[model samples]
Target: MNKGFYFERNLLALSRFDPALCSRLSGAETTRGRYRFIESRSGESIPALVDNSGAAHPLHSLVDPRREGKRLISTLGNEGFLIIFGLGGGFHIEAALEKTTIEGITVIDFDIHGVAELLSSREYIGIFNDPRFRLLVDPSAEALEQYILDRYKPVICGGISLLPLRTRADFSQGLFNQAGEAIKSAIDMVSADYSVQAYFGKRWFSNIIRNIAQAEQNTVPLAPVHSVAICAAGPSLDAQIPLLAERKNRPFIIAADTALPALISAGLTPDAVVSIDCQHISYYHFMAGLPEQTLLFLDLASPPLVASRSPRPYFFSGGHPLTRYISRYWRPIPEVDTSGANVTYAALSLAEYLCARNIELYGADFSYPRGTSYARGTYIRSLFENKQNRCIPLEALHSAFLYRTPLFKQGDENNSWYYETKPMAMYRLRLEEKVRSMKARIVVVPGMGAPIRLETNTGDNRTADTLRLFSSGKAAMGALEFLAQYRAGINALPLLQGPVYSFLTGLSKEETIIFTTLLPAAAALKRSAPELDTPELFDAVKKYCVGELEKLLGIWGMR
Candidate 1:
């Protein structure tokens, strides 16, 4: 074997793609005492990590690292994505490549110098050549997070498993710990999004059909707004409402669904009200009756009946892949980020989408400030009051709502208590991310909850004048025709038992678009029946989605 030739080829490949890493490897020759290569019983060489003290920590079994790596990877079955926390001479990663047909494998290691030394010794051209293989040397938390978000596909990948070389991790404890935290954070974020999709995937599709028809009739006005106030239903709204009412006409007001009742009771009229919740209970927010001038903005995934509450309602597509598919293929609909999982976030997205330069946040506490769940006159208060009876008292309902989730204390203060569940925390974190990147001047009102820290860009005066309206012209195919074609497309999907990619690749352009509409529902089914194999799971999802679509078609026929 031409060992020197192989090393030169690998070095050239590294230099081409990772020049910075190649530069670090300039003279990374390993000393005899520091790292010794030992041959195993199976005739495979394994490198040992030696510290300043005489202790040597071997990453894999001394008998055979390759054999041990293959055994470990065999237990993982067929996970589409593999994440290795420590490189450990790349034995595990190489074994994973040899044993599994995974979508990708990510390797993270703290020591760039050590990696360079290892690269200089071994031929890793195979790992480097594979398009799916990724190596992150000494990656920061943000870099690790961004890489995971860009690559990890919860729907396509199914699940991801994290493998760590304990001996290697013990050598660099702090770095591995940080990398672990980054992985958990990224996974949690993706899981939360997928969970939402599972619950509302079918609902989103059904609502999009109705909302698209509604949008066709009454389009959202493409007007320019200089400034806007986004009102959330936090307890702090009680104090902010007076000030908001005093200067009501100064800025355009976009009230969240929960805040609409509070604004109305405070003798204030918002310019518009936005609703994104898929539940029927969202209807309670509009019981007081919507004003004539107050336009209603709803997500395409919202309860279809809510759109009928206002004659001037405009529908915008939220963070649903199905909604996006409809917008792309059938008709164009205004899209906004609803990922924050709260109406307040949707309201903020609306203001930003409309190009509101100066945004004043009112009652966006995100937490239940001082044990209060909602504003003074929010719909929850009236709903509980109306449902009050001998069985369930009004105070009981209010208390139950406030203390439904475990509360956590935020900030250092005697009375700074707030209800913070995992979902609520995710919502706050998402909003913080959104607010940080916004070009608008965001002003947050201080309240008895977690403080929002966002960097503002006051100097920039970007306007939405360039925002074009959706084409009002009739689509090439009407809703009925589109449904008919979609039904045929679903019916044409390849049968189960083969690889999912093979089935997916067989689909035409129109069939692919139709396939995405069922992913959310499929993901939901996959969650409940996880024991089913990929093909079987997909077949079940196809059947369930087809049934739902048929029901929608029946309803559309009656309309």
Candidate 2:
């Protein structure tokens, strides 16, 4: 029997497979090749064979699982076209494929020989055929990377999709080390090109009209509409989905492209979906039997797959003329400035565009209170279900690396905090601010036990009449703690002069309401009373209530 005819490995067999070693994986066999391959406990070969160069070990030109893992998780927030530079025998690719939100995976490993070895296996045939997984074979990492830049780069910066990371390396640490000088030269060449970012900006200009259209959408007269619920695998979602289900009658329902199957298995059906992913292989979940009304908003600059999508018209972003034209001639388009690039923001932006003033946020718990990700569902069940114990360390890295802890003395009640790591919170706040300032009487109400302040210049109204907590009593709260000392003294009285005089001193009646909420010197001496367990200060509370009412009135065209 010609042993040379037998291919050595399978990409889909499992992780932790070593071709040189034996494991419990059923029907697993060593290939007739002399190369090293990825190994699993079950002895399944991952088709990752390299010569006895021990090159799979870390090298100067090689990337490690940790760094690639970080990029993979970080881009999950964006959930669009995610491209990894080196295939590295699919370890990082496997890690990334684990994320549900990401629509596509483009493993651009330039080593043509390695890629050929990978695709030859029966297990890998599924990945090749899978819509969400794309495997590009080029001669070397550098060429493949350039091909990506020439190809995938524009798709990302048009605010349409994102090329999460573009790097140069051979998956074989030994091979990468041998090519260190070449890799260095390639890196220098790219870094020295100088016009890359500016070039991207120019290409992005082609999409500006959509940006303007989206900006104008804020002024559009909209009816009260329901939104899709975008959920993540975070454990906090476990608590929020029930509450979300209770209100499903209102919102049409959408989930992170990944969350779709999870929600469906949990007896839910989303009306639509959103993803910026470009690779043809990332469509597995989105293409699953969707709800009849399901509409997906795809980034226009995504891979050509977006242009070729079927059954339902996956609307391209409004920033693209093609997208705007389609929405104009054919049907209404879903183009809202999602809080950010991820599904969560996409859902929010779409909801806002639909004029759903009441947004009920659930399963948005980005925190791993229990240090676990993935709710109970079959979508991710294949990768993680049976291996939870083995996966806890990964989750631990995920929790620590992904979640930036609030800087505060541990256990201190004064340590106020929120998940600031998800910048989408700040983006949501900004969107609300824009909505409120508009003629539309819009109010965004989303909060946990803590108060999330909308940073606005309207605080100027409170600055004059508002009293500091320290001025009221010794119970100097976190504000005082933040200051480290009490110094409001006589200067504080002058700060209120503007609001106080405007409110009390012979100002016209019309002007009075505008400054009516400002507290006076006497109010500063008042007691600090707050609803128990709430963070609002009494003087702060009074001034806030008055300011909001006055602002509302102003919004209503009242004097």
Clashes of each: 0, 29
Q: Global lDDT of each model?
A: 0.75, 0.41
Per-residue alpha-carbon lDDT of candidate 1 for residues 1-559, written as tens digits (9 for 90 to 100) = 3535545666677665467766665545433454555666776666677788876677778787777888888888667788987776677888887753576788898666566546655778877766567778888998898888766866666779988877888888988899899999898878777887777666666676656556657454566577899999988999998888788367999999899999999999988999998878899899888989898888878887898897657777785767777677666777888878888888888888877778898998888776678888898877788899999998788888877677776654666767666667778788988887777778887776667777543425463343544223346567776666666677887674343443555677767667767777777777777787666766887887667667777878822
Clashes of 2: 29
What TM-score would each prediction reach against the true structure?
Answer: 0.80, 0.34
User: How much is 399 displaced in model 2, in angstroms?
Assistant: 5.7
The prediction achieving the highest lDDT against the true structure is: 1
Q: Supply the TM-score for candidate 1.
A: 0.80
- Over 412-510, each residue of candidate 2 has an lDDT whose tens digit, in order, gives 245423333334444445444453442222222332212323344232221221121101112213321211111211112222221121223344442
